[model samples]
Target: MVPIDTPTLGDRSYLAHDGSVALVVDPQRDIDRVLALADEAGVRIAHVFETHIHNDYLTGGLALAEATGAAYHVNAADEVSYARTPISDGDVVEVSPSLRVRAIATPGHTFTHLSYALESVSDDGIEAVGVFTGGSLLFGATGRPDLLGHEHTSDLVHHQFSSAHRLADELPEHTHVLPTHGFGSFCSAGSTGDTTASTIGAEKRQNPALTQDEEKWVADTLAGLDAYPAYYAHMAPGNSTGPSAPDLSTPESADKETLATRIASGEWVVDLRTRTAFAAGHVTGTLNFGVDGQFATYLGWIIPWGTPLTLLGESPEQVAEAQRELVRIGIDHLEGAATGSPQDWTDAPLGSFERAVFADLAQVRHHREVSVLDVRRTSEFDEAHISGAVNVPLHELLDRVDEVPSGEVWVHCAGGYRASIAASVLAARGVHVVAVDDSFDEGAKPSGLPIAAA
Candidate 1:
């Protein structure tokens, strides 16, 4: 078994085979990665399985199955428009003489979610290998139950608790617990810790879903969830209707004037450079969503859906990487792109901002009046934050930019990523701003600044 990880989005797709034929689970929209892995392993992809219609990313299962001429397996209850080999609880698929998969009803992440348990058929008799607990059972957590909407959260969370216990009770302790979410995906209801692999025995001892009572687990899980990306609203619909392969070909190159025009016309002209490099010099009005740092998640969270987007990267590769991230979230197309330095993009004087540390913020605070903006989520801010800092999260910053008080605004997130994004938004509006480009725990807490809890 080989796990294909999408760390930025905190999800995994698995490819398991019996030396000749392979079955894939929860593939991302880019099918090329899966195809390459299969070809390198000298195996044919015979089956594609989805634990559920994903809410985080458009599934590549249908596209990959179509490309490989494989059988596509999805829940029989899903109201998808595409034709698929309908699977339900208790149904078993014999992939080869050595490999077979049994579907187990584990609806928690979604109403019709199913987990597939791999069984190895041997001369000694059939033995279970592991179960693909997509969003139902994660590393140390379970999938968040709120993605379906507030109306279903209560029932689904209860269902999530029951589903997790069911897996722990039914699967053998030695059976591997391979899950699709919890690596870093927002689908996780709590922390997944840092482990790479786990077994049912380990999960039963450590996972919140397995250790806590259903009532407490449901309450804690719901309380721990912060806002997920706005683009999530589009993922299920895109997956259900069957999305085609993304057009990853380089977008039409935009000149300086075109980029300016797009920015002026209320389009998102994003700068995909390093936050430090972006702060040094960038075209005025271009928002910074550095490709190096959770680019798609924050960008997709903030950008108005279906708005025309143009990327400004330092290279063609950067632009392409950003394009790939966008496509996974169902942002299929880019308006245009421009690669190279700010100088290459524009002859006009570029916008610039100060990139400081927590110490600098403290020093500046002592000397002059400045508005300190904390751009982390409200839950994060409430846990602890620098005293007197205005709490407008990065996702809500654009809409609430006016709420940020006038004068020099110094912004910081837990780390520096979201701070740069917030700084860019402020700088674009001609607000004097500085990005605290250092770790909060490693910098802010130790920098002798006053920390307070809400």
Candidate 2:
């Protein structure tokens, strides 16, 4: 088994093969990497299996199947409006003479979710090797059930509880557990330790979802859920309706005049340069969602759905990378791209902002009037924050801009990424802003600023 890790989405796709034949599970929209891996391994990809209709990233199943002449396998229960070989519980698929995969209806993360158990089938019998649990079970926690919307939350949680125990009870103790979510993925109920690979034996002994009583498990899982990116709402429908293949052609270069016109017409002009570089100089009205940080998540959170966007990057490679990340979240309306410094791309005078450490912010607060805005999540803010800071999560800042009083707003998140986002939003709104590009822990020190505990 080979794991394909997409760090941007914090998800994993797996290629399981036995010598000449292989199958891909939960692949991302970019199918090139999976193709390359299969080519390198000298194996034919005969099938693509989706454990569930993903609500996080666009799956490359259809495109991959089209390219490889492989059959796409989806759960029969999910009414996906696309061509696929509908699989049901207990259905066994033979990939090769030695490799066999069985679909087990998990039905936790989604109502129609399936977990595939790969086994080595010899003349003697079959031995289970690994199971791709997808979002049903993770290293420490199970997939959160709230993504189906609030109405299904209670029912899904109940299903999740039953599904987790079923996997534990049915799978062999030695079977390897591989999950698609929970490696920094927002789809997870919470952080599931750090390790990504484990066995059913290990999980049964240590996984909270498997060990806790059903009621406690449901309560804890529900309580631990955090706010996910706004773009997630579009994924389920896109997957159900069958997402179109991604067009990875190089984005056309937008000349200075066209860029300016688009900016004037209220198009999203995202600067994919470094945050420090963005702060030093940028096109006047552009928002900085630097590629160096959680670029796609923050950009998707703030940008309106279906907004035509253009990219400004330091190089062609940066623009290409940013485009790939954007496509994963279904943000594909990239109108054009420009690669150069701010001056090379535009004739307008460059904009700049002050970047401060926590100590600098503390001194500024002591000396002059400043509104400290904490752009971390409400949970993070409730745990602890600066005494006078107004909590406006980065995801909610665009709509709640008026809540921030007019003044020099000193913005900070746990680190600086969200703070940079908040600063850019405030700057675009013509609010005086000082982005505190420093650690919140250092800022909350007794020697620095007054810390408020919730």
Candidate 3:
């Protein structure tokens, strides 16, 4: 089975076998690595499954399907524009002579969320060997309940609770658990002790939220979740029933002229190349959210929820993955992409934002004249924080800014997406803001920095 937190730079890759075929779960935009591995293994990907209409990176399922001709699978209840077969709880799909899959409705993370049980070969795909928990269940965590909007949070909580409890009580104790998202993903409620893959048994023992009753589960999740990125709402409705994804098979490289036009036309250009590659030289102003790592989640944070987005990547697949990743977070009002320079477009002038790493942060502290705002959840602040920062998670930043002293506010998060959203919230309200990246651990402390928390 392909694990999420491997030595590889990619999100996660799993190849499950019932002895005859392979099933791939939630292949994020970083597919080249896995595709190459697939080639080496000499195995054809039989099924590409997405647990939900993702909100992190765009689903590579569509591209993987196009590339390998695998059947694209999603929960029957989910609505996406792409062509896919409906998968539901208790429905068994035969992948090979020995391997088979049974779908389980694991909603609450999303309305149409699902989990699949992979069974080993027997009389005919009978014994479930393990379950690929598509953001439904994790080693030390579970999926968030607010994705569908909290109108019926109470009900969604029960749905999620039921799903988790079912896994705990029904699934075999030895059944392997592979979750689609792990530590850095906004999908998981929280890091369950810095891990990506964990067993169902291990989760049942350690995950406090999983063991809690439904009431506590919902409360803890809502309380600890980082403020909902502004993009959350925007991406959900669009992804629910959006347009078919553009096919970028045998991708074409964008030229300097096309790149210039894209930047000028007021589109946010995201460079999905490696950080070192990005830092070496790039079109000035392009935001650097790398592809192989946490692109989907971070990109959703910086680009504002409903802003028109365009990609300025190194290759055609990079561009397509960027587009898909944006859509996963519900940013589907996509404008067409160009393959040339920014000067190609004279109508609009798109701006750029620099990559903020663990370094370059002391500038504000050195001056002792900048305000630091932390955009992680309240629990994260309680766990740790930067020496002198405030904890105004992105969700409350808009309403809570009145508490700040009103100065040059420099916002930051574990990386920078939430901080970017927090900064955007302040900017939209006529506040001067600069989003920073202090990682999450280093930014959790409260010193002279004007950060907020308990």
Candidate 4:
């Protein structure tokens, strides 16, 4: 237990194991929370570092560094299109006056991923106070090695094997391990274990990801890596180009004309409103996954990762929070957001789509003879689902389209994002898909819907 020194900087963190001073690891676009915490603690941010060129959160390290006059550090192996202080194996950096960070090159999660070691000198010897393993090692698991190209999968596995052992062998027995990702993050396997931070000795003993059989472990782990979204392809190129940080706290509102322009140009419309709120009235083709729906998780699933997203909500604050939420799930490349209602877009009688509720969906399934495909994870479908629904997890849907019946297809996830992605995949195959709008959360029965025990 790191004593909850990490206050989930609004889904990220600001503190290390000991809260005397703070080390901001992988700060997302809106760093106001971190800034405020540092201010409250009456301490300056000793150092700001990126674990690697994140495909998920738009890094605020550079911006935060500029604002606070802190030194920015990344992996020495990475040559991201910006001037950054590089850190390699056994490299230590001084933060402010007395604090120091030792960089341990832990590649495999990303080409440029490095874990920062806090050099706290004691009567015994110089040892790291805490290890900030950004996207490299999680409490229950480690980062996915296949995020990059498979060309280096072998090298990554080799490095990851060595990297885990390196941390296991070297990090102090009491040194705290703080990971960038927490629960609900697919970046690391077994993230749902709820083990936030653990001692080096504890991790070495328990974490299966850290055990010795390097080659086989790496091969097996990397083999099952899932495909990233199309949006990530776009955002990564830019993230690699240089330090691109968006002011997440200050998302600007777009007018109706601007919203219409983007929508007309065929950019996907993401309505960050509740299902009931969206069903009342919404622009046609706009997908609704409310801020309450693990906002970014749904965005990560449904919206193409790097697709130029334009947020629409009841207000500006809501949209800003939505953008930050999207960043948390690695969906960068945002366009802008509609602060107020762009009634003009809805007023027009152009191409539009509506929400598909349970009643409407039931009537359609009975009336039109459609193939209801449930795209939840196989385990979830095996648990329970709508009757006669085909089971195919969103990640595996594209490969197993044969299971998708020839008739009209209506897709759904625990919510809507997975459904949207499934629908998109089916649509590309020339099969039209209707996303069920009312299935907000898993096992939810809104008014009238039936499910069979699996």
Candidate 5:
């Protein structure tokens, strides 16, 4: 077994093989890595299985199946447009003479979710070894059930409760629990303390969704759900119809004149430099989405779907890395890229923003007509924040920029990553941005700024 971890998305795909035959589960859109792993393992891929119509990232199941002549398996209930082996609850597939995988319908995150349990078959009969619990039962939490939208939240919460119990009841205590959506994934209702690997026995004892009272579990899960990226809306539909195979070829390189033309035409020009470097100097009108931060999530959230985008990075490597992140969420309309400093690329006057700490803001807030924009989530704002700060969650900033009062704007989130993103968005719109690029804890003190509950 090999676990292919995409750290940016906090998602995992697996290759389970018994000597000569292999089965892939929940693969991401980029199939090259899976293919490389299979080649190294000296096994031919025999099947590809999708847990559900993924709402977070594009799936490469159809493309991989076509490439390798493997049978692609998907839940019949999903009614996906692509041709696939329609798998249902309790369907067992024998991948090799010794390995058998059985499908378990575990719908909660989506209506068509399925979990596959791997078993070892021998003369002593089938012995279960592990299970791919895909968005149903996570390590220390259950998958959030509200991805289908507000109308289905309560109904899916009920289903999630039943599904968690079902997994705990049916699987052996020793069965290894491998999930696709818990390790820092936004699909989870809340943080799971960063746990990545566990067994059914441990989850039964530690997972709140498994141990808590059914009603209380559902209530807590529903209450803690946070807003996800806007790009998520396009993923399920794209996957349902079978997303086109990702084009991993390097994008065209844009010269200084080409980049200028694109920017003048109102296309998105993203700077993949460090936040500090971006704040020091950048091409005017370009938004800074640092390569080191959560680049894809924030970029996808703010950029309109199908908008032609071009990237400016320090090197070809940085641009390529950012491109990979962008394609994971199906943002494939990359027009081109340019690699150089602002001075090297263009003669336009460089733009910059003021970086400040919370304590510095405490002094400035009393004197100037400044507006503090809290870009954290609503829940974070409700806990404690600067008494007069306006709440505009980072994910919704592009749509609600008008709500942020004019004048010198100070933006911040729990950490500096979101604050940088918010600052860049505001800066791109010609708003004077002061990025509070430091820890929120240092700024939340009473001595630094007056604190109040939302």
Candidate 6:
């Protein structure tokens, strides 16, 4: 079994083979990576599986199956527009002489979710090896049930608990547990822990769905779920209709005047650079969504859907990388891109902002009137935050910008990443902003700032 991990989205795709023929599970929009992996393994992809209609990233399943002429396997009950070899619960497919796949109905993440049990066939007998739990069962937690919508959350959580127990009871104790979400993806109900490896036996001992009662498990899981990406609203619909392969081609090059015009017209001119570099200098009215951070997730969450996007990067490679990330969330094409220093992208004195650590924020508070802004989720702010800090999550910042108290606003999150994104948005909107570029626990809690519980 070979796992293809897309860390940015905190999801993993799997490829299992019998040395010659392989089956792929939950591939991302970029099929090239999976194709390259199969090529490197010297195996022909004979099947592609969708554990569920994904809500996080566009699936590359249809495109990959078409590309490889392989049988695409989706749940029989899934309302999809494309043709696929629909598999139902208890149905088993012989992928090759030595490999077999059995579908198990494990609806929770979605109403039609299925987990595939991989078995190795031999002259001795057929033995189950691993189960691809998809969004149903994760490493330590289960997938969040609220992604479908608030109306379905309660019913889904109950199903999620039952599905997890079903996997534990039916699968062998030693059977490896493979899942597609919960690495850092918001789809997870709770922490997934640091280990990448787990088995049914281990999960039974530690997983809440296994250890806790159904009522307790449901309550805890529901309580733990926070806000997920806003772009998730578009993913399942895009996947159900069968999205085509992503267009990763380089966009048209834009000069300084073009970038200026686009920004003036309210197009999203994003800077793909470090927060420090972006704070040092960047094109006026352009927002910073450093490519090295969770660039696509935050950018997709905050930007208006279908808005023209132009990327400004220090190098062509940076812009290219951003394009790939954006496509995973179904932002397929770019309006344009510009690469080079801020001076090269703009003739006017480039826009700039102040980036400070928590220590600086602590010292600055004593001297002047500054509105402290916490850009983390509501749950995070509720647990602990700087005393007197206004809570406006980064995802909701754009729409609730006026709620932020006026004056010099000092923005922060659990880490520096979200803070920088918020700072950029506020800066672009003419709010005096200072990004707190430090860990909240290591910085704010100990930096002489009065931390208070909401």
Model 1 spans with C-alpha error above 4 angstroms: none
Highest lDDT among the candidates is held by which one?
1
Which stretches of candidate 6 lie above 4 Å from their native place?
none
Residue 88, candidate 5: how far off, in angstroms?
0.9
Please report how far candidate 2 places residue 40 from its true position, in Å.
Answer: 0.9
Better of 1 and 6 by lDDT: 1
Clashing pairs for model 2 are none
TM-score of each: 0.99, 0.97, 0.69, 0.74, 0.95, 0.98
- Of candidate 3, the 10-residue stretch with the lowest lDDT total is 4-13
Q: Who is ahead in lDDT, 1 or 5?
A: 1
Q: List, residue by residue over 156-175, the lDDT tens digit for candidate 1.
A: 99889999999999989999
Poorest lDDT segment (10 consecutive residues) of candidate 4: 1-10
Candidate 5 Cα outliers beyond 4 Å, as residue runs: 363-369
Off by over 4 Å in 2: none
Candidate 6 lDDT, 283-390, residue by residue in tens: 778899999988888898888999999999999999999999999999987889999999999899878889999999889988988999999999999999999999
- Candidate 2 C-alpha lDDT tens digits along 1-454: 9999987687999998987899999999989999999999999999999999998888898889988999999998889888999999999999998999999988878999999999998989999899999999898888989998899999999998888888889889999999999787888886787796799999999888788888888888888778999988989988888777788889988999998999889898999987799899888888999898778877887788998999999999999999999988888768999998999878888888999888887787778888889999998999898898899888998899889978788899988988887888788778889988887876558446888878
Residue 76 local lDDT, model 3: 68
True-structure Cα RMSD, model 6: 0.9
Clashes of 3: 48
